[model samples]
Target: MMGKTLVLVTGMVTLLSACTMMDQPKSLAFRHNAVTADPQAAGTAQVTTRPDGMVTTTLVLTGLTPGKTYAAHYHAFGPDSSTDPCASNGPVSVGFPSFTADASGRATTSVSSEMARIAGDLGAYINVHYADDLKVVPVCAPIKMTKG
Candidate 1:
Protein backbone atom coordinates (compact mmCIF):
# COMPACT_ATOMS: atom_id res chain seq x y z
CA MET A 1 0.00 0.00 0.00
CA MET A 2 2.79 2.47 0.83
CA GLY A 3 4.58 1.76 -2.44
CA LYS A 4 1.39 2.28 -4.46
CA THR A 5 0.65 5.59 -2.67
CA LEU A 6 4.17 6.84 -3.36
CA VAL A 7 3.87 6.14 -7.09
CA LEU A 8 0.49 7.89 -7.26
CA VAL A 9 1.87 10.99 -5.57
CA THR A 10 4.87 11.11 -7.85
CA GLY A 11 2.66 10.77 -10.93
CA MET A 12 0.42 13.60 -9.78
CA VAL A 13 3.42 15.87 -9.26
CA THR A 14 4.80 15.04 -12.70
CA LEU A 15 1.48 15.81 -14.33
CA LEU A 16 1.27 19.17 -12.55
CA SER A 17 4.81 20.09 -13.46
CA ALA A 18 4.17 19.28 -17.14
CA CYS A 19 1.10 21.47 -17.14
CA THR A 20 3.00 24.39 -15.62
CA MET A 21 5.87 23.95 -18.04
CA MET A 22 3.63 24.56 -21.03
CA ASP A 23 4.44 27.68 -23.07
CA GLN A 24 2.88 30.93 -21.95
CA PRO A 25 1.01 32.80 -24.64
CA LYS A 26 1.68 36.48 -25.25
CA SER A 27 -1.05 38.95 -24.42
CA LEU A 28 -2.68 41.29 -26.94
CA ALA A 29 -2.96 44.91 -25.83
CA PHE A 30 -6.11 46.91 -26.34
CA ARG A 31 -5.85 50.49 -27.50
CA HIS A 32 -8.34 53.32 -27.73
CA ASN A 33 -10.06 53.05 -31.09
CA ALA A 34 -8.33 56.05 -32.63
CA VAL A 35 -11.04 56.47 -35.25
CA THR A 36 -13.61 56.80 -32.50
CA ALA A 37 -11.67 57.49 -29.37
CA ASP A 38 -13.01 56.70 -25.95
CA PRO A 39 -10.59 58.53 -23.69
CA GLN A 40 -11.45 56.29 -20.76
CA ALA A 41 -11.22 52.82 -22.24
CA ALA A 42 -8.32 50.37 -22.06
CA GLY A 43 -7.78 46.63 -21.82
CA THR A 44 -5.76 43.51 -22.62
CA ALA A 45 -6.60 40.28 -24.43
CA GLN A 46 -4.90 37.00 -23.61
CA VAL A 47 -5.13 33.91 -25.83
CA THR A 48 -4.24 30.51 -24.48
CA THR A 49 -3.87 27.48 -26.69
CA ARG A 50 -4.85 24.28 -24.98
CA PRO A 51 -3.13 20.96 -25.43
CA ASP A 52 -5.80 19.92 -27.92
CA GLY A 53 -5.31 23.11 -30.00
CA MET A 54 -8.50 24.91 -28.94
CA VAL A 55 -7.80 28.51 -28.00
CA THR A 56 -9.44 30.54 -25.28
CA THR A 57 -9.20 34.30 -25.11
CA THR A 58 -9.93 36.40 -22.07
CA LEU A 59 -10.45 40.14 -22.26
CA VAL A 60 -9.67 42.24 -19.20
CA LEU A 61 -10.81 45.84 -19.28
CA THR A 62 -10.67 49.10 -17.39
CA GLY A 63 -12.10 52.62 -17.75
CA LEU A 64 -15.51 51.89 -19.21
CA THR A 65 -18.80 53.62 -18.43
CA PRO A 66 -19.94 52.04 -15.18
CA GLY A 67 -22.87 49.62 -15.44
CA LYS A 68 -23.08 49.87 -19.21
CA THR A 69 -23.52 46.74 -21.33
CA TYR A 70 -20.85 45.91 -23.87
CA ALA A 71 -20.20 43.31 -26.58
CA ALA A 72 -16.94 42.07 -28.02
CA HIS A 73 -15.84 39.82 -30.87
CA TYR A 74 -12.91 38.50 -32.84
CA HIS A 75 -13.06 39.92 -36.35
CA ALA A 76 -11.53 39.07 -39.68
CA PHE A 77 -9.61 41.54 -41.78
CA GLY A 78 -12.23 43.75 -43.40
CA PRO A 79 -12.45 45.67 -46.63
CA ASP A 80 -11.91 49.07 -45.04
CA SER A 81 -8.10 49.05 -44.68
CA SER A 82 -5.26 46.60 -44.93
CA THR A 83 -2.69 48.32 -42.79
CA ASP A 84 -4.87 48.75 -39.72
CA PRO A 85 -6.86 45.68 -38.78
CA CYS A 86 -8.74 47.59 -36.10
CA ALA A 87 -9.93 50.13 -38.65
CA SER A 88 -10.66 47.54 -41.28
CA ASN A 89 -14.33 47.16 -40.30
CA GLY A 90 -14.05 43.41 -40.20
CA PRO A 91 -16.85 40.94 -39.73
CA VAL A 92 -17.19 38.93 -36.54
CA SER A 93 -15.40 35.63 -36.49
CA VAL A 94 -16.15 34.73 -32.90
CA GLY A 95 -18.07 36.67 -30.27
CA PHE A 96 -17.41 36.82 -26.56
CA PRO A 97 -20.11 36.68 -23.94
CA SER A 98 -21.74 40.09 -23.37
CA PHE A 99 -20.55 41.78 -20.21
CA THR A 100 -21.23 44.89 -18.17
CA ALA A 101 -18.82 47.20 -16.46
CA ASP A 102 -18.79 47.28 -12.69
CA ALA A 103 -19.27 50.35 -10.52
CA SER A 104 -15.50 50.80 -10.72
CA GLY A 105 -15.49 50.91 -14.54
CA ARG A 106 -13.84 47.57 -15.11
CA ALA A 107 -14.95 44.28 -16.70
CA THR A 108 -13.64 40.88 -17.67
CA THR A 109 -15.01 38.38 -20.19
CA SER A 110 -13.79 35.34 -22.02
CA VAL A 111 -14.57 33.06 -24.97
CA SER A 112 -13.24 29.71 -26.10
CA SER A 113 -12.89 29.07 -29.83
CA GLU A 114 -11.32 26.61 -32.17
CA MET A 115 -7.89 27.54 -33.43
CA ALA A 116 -9.07 27.48 -37.04
CA ARG A 117 -11.70 30.15 -36.50
CA ILE A 118 -9.09 32.73 -35.53
CA ALA A 119 -6.14 31.51 -37.55
CA GLY A 120 -4.06 33.81 -39.78
CA ASP A 121 -5.94 36.77 -41.30
CA LEU A 122 -9.29 35.45 -40.15
CA GLY A 123 -8.83 36.70 -36.62
CA ALA A 124 -7.35 40.08 -37.31
CA TYR A 125 -8.59 41.99 -34.30
CA ILE A 126 -10.96 42.17 -31.37
CA ASN A 127 -13.29 45.14 -30.90
CA VAL A 128 -15.54 46.14 -28.06
CA HIS A 129 -18.88 47.84 -28.80
CA TYR A 130 -21.76 49.28 -26.87
CA ALA A 131 -24.48 46.66 -26.49
CA ASP A 132 -27.21 49.25 -26.87
CA ASP A 133 -25.58 50.87 -29.86
CA LEU A 134 -23.14 48.91 -31.95
CA LYS A 135 -21.93 52.00 -33.78
CA VAL A 136 -19.95 53.06 -30.76
CA VAL A 137 -16.65 51.23 -30.23
CA PRO A 138 -14.36 52.11 -27.36
CA VAL A 139 -11.39 49.81 -27.68
CA CYS A 140 -9.75 47.40 -30.09
CA ALA A 141 -7.04 44.78 -29.69
CA PRO A 142 -5.15 43.96 -32.86
CA ILE A 143 -4.08 40.34 -33.20
CA LYS A 144 -2.97 39.84 -36.76
CA MET A 145 -1.23 43.16 -37.39
CA THR A 146 -1.01 42.80 -41.15
CA LYS A 147 -3.46 41.29 -43.58
CA GLY A 148 -2.53 39.58 -46.81
Candidate 2:
Protein backbone atom coordinates (compact mmCIF):
# COMPACT_ATOMS: atom_id res chain seq x y z
CA MET A 1 0.00 0.00 0.00
CA MET A 2 2.77 2.45 0.89
CA GLY A 3 4.59 1.88 -2.39
CA LYS A 4 1.40 2.32 -4.38
CA THR A 5 0.63 5.57 -2.59
CA LEU A 6 4.10 6.86 -3.34
CA VAL A 7 3.73 6.08 -7.00
CA LEU A 8 0.32 7.73 -7.10
CA VAL A 9 1.63 10.90 -5.45
CA THR A 10 4.58 11.02 -7.81
CA GLY A 11 2.29 10.73 -10.77
CA MET A 12 0.10 13.52 -9.48
CA VAL A 13 3.10 15.78 -8.97
CA THR A 14 4.33 15.12 -12.49
CA LEU A 15 0.93 15.96 -13.91
CA LEU A 16 0.81 19.21 -11.97
CA SER A 17 4.26 20.18 -13.11
CA ALA A 18 3.33 19.53 -16.72
CA CYS A 19 0.70 22.28 -16.55
CA THR A 20 3.51 24.82 -16.29
CA MET A 21 6.21 23.73 -18.68
CA MET A 22 8.76 26.44 -18.11
CA ASP A 23 11.73 26.56 -15.76
CA GLN A 24 13.50 29.65 -14.43
CA PRO A 25 17.27 29.56 -14.17
CA LYS A 26 17.76 33.17 -13.18
CA SER A 27 15.74 36.34 -12.75
CA LEU A 28 16.60 39.64 -14.42
CA ALA A 29 15.63 42.87 -12.69
CA PHE A 30 13.71 45.60 -14.44
CA ARG A 31 14.52 49.28 -14.26
CA HIS A 32 12.43 52.29 -15.14
CA ASN A 33 13.55 54.04 -18.30
CA ALA A 34 15.27 57.37 -17.64
CA VAL A 35 12.48 59.02 -19.54
CA THR A 36 9.85 56.55 -18.45
CA ALA A 37 6.22 57.20 -19.21
CA ASP A 38 5.12 55.22 -16.14
CA PRO A 39 7.65 55.68 -13.43
CA GLN A 40 5.49 53.91 -10.90
CA ALA A 41 5.93 50.48 -12.51
CA ALA A 42 8.41 47.83 -11.42
CA GLY A 43 9.08 44.22 -12.35
CA THR A 44 11.42 41.36 -13.18
CA ALA A 45 11.71 39.02 -16.12
CA GLN A 46 13.03 35.54 -15.54
CA VAL A 47 14.60 33.89 -18.57
CA THR A 48 15.11 30.17 -18.73
CA THR A 49 16.35 27.95 -21.50
CA ARG A 50 15.04 24.41 -21.69
CA PRO A 51 16.87 21.33 -22.87
CA ASP A 52 14.67 21.29 -25.96
CA GLY A 53 16.11 24.57 -27.24
CA MET A 54 13.10 26.58 -26.16
CA VAL A 55 13.08 29.75 -24.08
CA THR A 56 10.62 30.98 -21.53
CA THR A 57 10.23 34.48 -20.14
CA THR A 58 8.16 35.01 -17.05
CA LEU A 59 7.32 38.55 -16.00
CA VAL A 60 5.97 39.72 -12.69
CA LEU A 61 4.98 43.36 -12.46
CA THR A 62 3.78 45.82 -9.84
CA GLY A 63 2.59 49.40 -9.44
CA LEU A 64 0.84 49.53 -12.80
CA THR A 65 -2.49 51.15 -13.58
CA PRO A 66 -4.89 48.76 -11.96
CA GLY A 67 -7.02 46.87 -14.47
CA LYS A 68 -5.28 48.36 -17.49
CA THR A 69 -3.96 46.23 -20.32
CA TYR A 70 -0.21 45.88 -20.75
CA ALA A 71 2.09 44.11 -23.19
CA ALA A 72 5.53 42.60 -22.87
CA HIS A 73 8.11 41.50 -25.42
CA TYR A 74 11.62 40.30 -26.03
CA HIS A 75 13.53 42.67 -28.29
CA ALA A 76 16.49 42.26 -30.58
CA PHE A 77 19.58 44.36 -30.17
CA GLY A 78 19.22 47.44 -32.37
CA PRO A 79 21.70 49.56 -34.29
CA ASP A 80 21.57 52.59 -32.08
CA SER A 81 24.37 51.44 -29.74
CA SER A 82 26.59 48.51 -28.83
CA THR A 83 26.85 48.60 -25.04
CA ASP A 84 23.37 49.47 -23.89
CA PRO A 85 20.85 47.04 -25.27
CA CYS A 86 17.97 48.77 -23.52
CA ALA A 87 18.78 52.07 -25.18
CA SER A 88 19.55 50.45 -28.49
CA ASN A 89 16.05 50.93 -29.92
CA GLY A 90 15.69 47.19 -30.48
CA PRO A 91 12.73 45.66 -32.26
CA VAL A 92 10.41 43.02 -30.85
CA SER A 93 11.50 39.39 -31.18
CA VAL A 94 8.80 37.68 -29.17
CA GLY A 95 5.61 39.02 -27.64
CA PHE A 96 3.83 37.74 -24.56
CA PRO A 97 0.10 37.62 -24.16
CA SER A 98 -1.49 40.91 -23.11
CA PHE A 99 -2.48 41.03 -19.50
CA THR A 100 -4.31 43.37 -17.14
CA ALA A 101 -3.20 44.19 -13.65
CA ASP A 102 -5.37 43.31 -10.73
CA ALA A 103 -6.98 45.86 -8.41
CA SER A 104 -3.72 46.02 -6.49
CA GLY A 105 -1.80 47.00 -9.62
CA ARG A 106 0.07 43.75 -9.96
CA ALA A 107 0.25 41.28 -12.85
CA THR A 108 2.08 38.16 -13.98
CA THR A 109 2.50 36.72 -17.46
CA SER A 110 4.77 34.42 -19.39
CA VAL A 111 5.74 33.60 -22.98
CA SER A 112 7.52 30.67 -24.57
CA SER A 113 9.41 30.53 -27.84
CA GLU A 114 11.98 28.45 -29.62
CA MET A 115 15.41 29.47 -28.39
CA ALA A 116 16.64 30.21 -31.89
CA ARG A 117 14.11 33.01 -32.23
CA ILE A 118 15.70 35.01 -29.44
CA ALA A 119 19.22 33.71 -29.25
CA GLY A 120 22.22 36.07 -28.79
CA ASP A 121 21.59 39.61 -30.04
CA LEU A 122 18.03 38.81 -30.89
CA GLY A 123 17.18 38.54 -27.20
CA ALA A 124 18.87 41.65 -26.03
CA TYR A 125 16.15 42.94 -23.73
CA ILE A 126 12.57 42.76 -22.60
CA ASN A 127 10.27 45.69 -21.96
CA VAL A 128 6.83 46.30 -20.64
CA HIS A 129 4.62 48.72 -22.50
CA TYR A 130 1.10 50.05 -22.45
CA ALA A 131 -0.95 47.89 -24.79
CA ASP A 132 -2.85 50.92 -26.02
CA ASP A 133 0.24 53.12 -26.39
CA LEU A 134 3.51 51.40 -27.25
CA LYS A 135 5.46 54.61 -26.80
CA VAL A 136 4.78 54.45 -23.09
CA VAL A 137 7.39 52.01 -21.90
CA PRO A 138 7.54 51.90 -18.15
CA VAL A 139 10.09 49.22 -17.40
CA CYS A 140 12.85 47.29 -19.11
CA ALA A 141 14.74 44.14 -18.20
CA PRO A 142 18.02 43.96 -20.03
CA ILE A 143 18.97 40.39 -20.93
CA LYS A 144 22.12 40.80 -22.97
CA MET A 145 23.58 44.00 -21.51
CA THR A 146 25.77 44.46 -24.55
CA LYS A 147 25.07 43.71 -28.17
CA GLY A 148 26.42 40.38 -29.34
Best by lDDT: 1
Clashing pairs in 2: none
RMSD of each: 5.8, 7.0
True-vs-predicted CA distance for residue 113, candidate 1, Å: 0.4
List the pairs of residues colliding in candidate 1.
none
Decoy 2 TM-score against native: 0.80
Model 1 stretches astray by more than 4 angstroms? 1-23, 35-37
lDDT of 1 by residue, 1-148 (tens): 9999999999999998877655466699999975553578998998888888789899999999899999999999999999999999999999999999999999999999999999898899999999999888999999988886
lDDT of each: 0.90, 0.87
Evaluate model 1: give its TM-score: 0.83
Looking at candidate 1, the ten consecutive residues that score lowest on lDDT are: 17-26
- TM-scores across all candidates? 0.83, 0.80
Best by TM-score: 1
